[model samples]
Target: MNQTQILVIGRHPEILATVIRLVNNNPAWNATGCITDEEAMSTFDKQTFAMVLLGGGIEEPSEDKLCAYFTSRNPDIKIVQHYGGGSGLLSAEIYEALE
Candidate 1:
């Protein structure tokens, strides 16, 4: 079985770690976390991610740019904003986006 690759972008280390852990809990999913837009863009260039999750720690303008970057690269890529919800909500959002 192939797992879905998820790229999580956030400025906070703790939140990024939590999001990575939650996404990886499901066997069908794999996740990578980036602390800055530069890191995220670099990783995105090297990877084929199915989705990108923008965490609450990222500012509005940065998030917008990241979203634009990813979407421009892959027009159909799924990008979702995450605002520190529980693991369940996070999981649900991810699955929904993938679906």
Candidate 2:
């Protein structure tokens, strides 16, 4: 099965881990979490991501850079801002983005 690759970027390690865990729980999704801009860029470069979930705590500057980079790489890439929500909301956000 071809799983949907998701790039999860957050400033907080705990939040990043939790987001990754929740995303990966679904058989259709696979998440790669990063806590730093460098790490996120590196991972994103090495892997093809269908969607990017920007978690809480990310600085506006960093988010802009990442979004620009992602857009440059894949103009059609789906990007979502996820902050302080339950797994249900997260799932809904992702599903909505996919549409």
Candidate 3:
């Protein structure tokens, strides 16, 4: 079966790890986490993701830059600002984006 692709970016490694774990829990989804904008962009350029999860620790400037870069690459891309919520909210956000 094919799985949905998701790119997650967070400033904190621990938070990013948690997000990655939660995202990977879903059998139908696959996620990649990055702690830096450059890494995120580099990963993004290598593959296509249906959605992007931005962590709370990300700065406004970085967020703007990332969003701009992603939008430039895929205007229809889905971007979500995730603030360390439980798995339920994360799933809901992902489901909502796919909807």
- lDDT of all the models against the reference? 0.92, 0.93, 0.93
Better of 1 and 2 by lDDT: 2
Question: Tens digits of per-residue lDDT for model 1 on 68-93?
Answer: 89999999999998897799999999
TM-score of each: 0.97, 0.97, 0.97
In candidate 1, which residue pairs get closer than 3 Å at backbone N, Cα or C atoms, i.e. clash?
none
Give the clash count for each candidate: 0, 0, 0
Q: How many Å off is the CA of 64 in candidate 2?
A: 0.7
Q: Model 3 reaches what TM-score against the true structure?
A: 0.97
Q: For residue 26, what is the lDDT in candidate 2? A: 95
Checking candidate 2 for backbone clashes, the offending pairs are: none
**Model 3 C-alpha lDDT per residue in residues 23-92, reported as the tens digit of each score:** 9999999999999999999999999899999988898999999999999999999999988669999999
Consecutive 10-residue window with the lowest summed lDDT within model 1: 55-64
Candidate 3, residue 33: CA error in Å?
0.5
Winner by lDDT:
3
Q: Candidate 1: misplaced stretches above 4 Å?
A: none
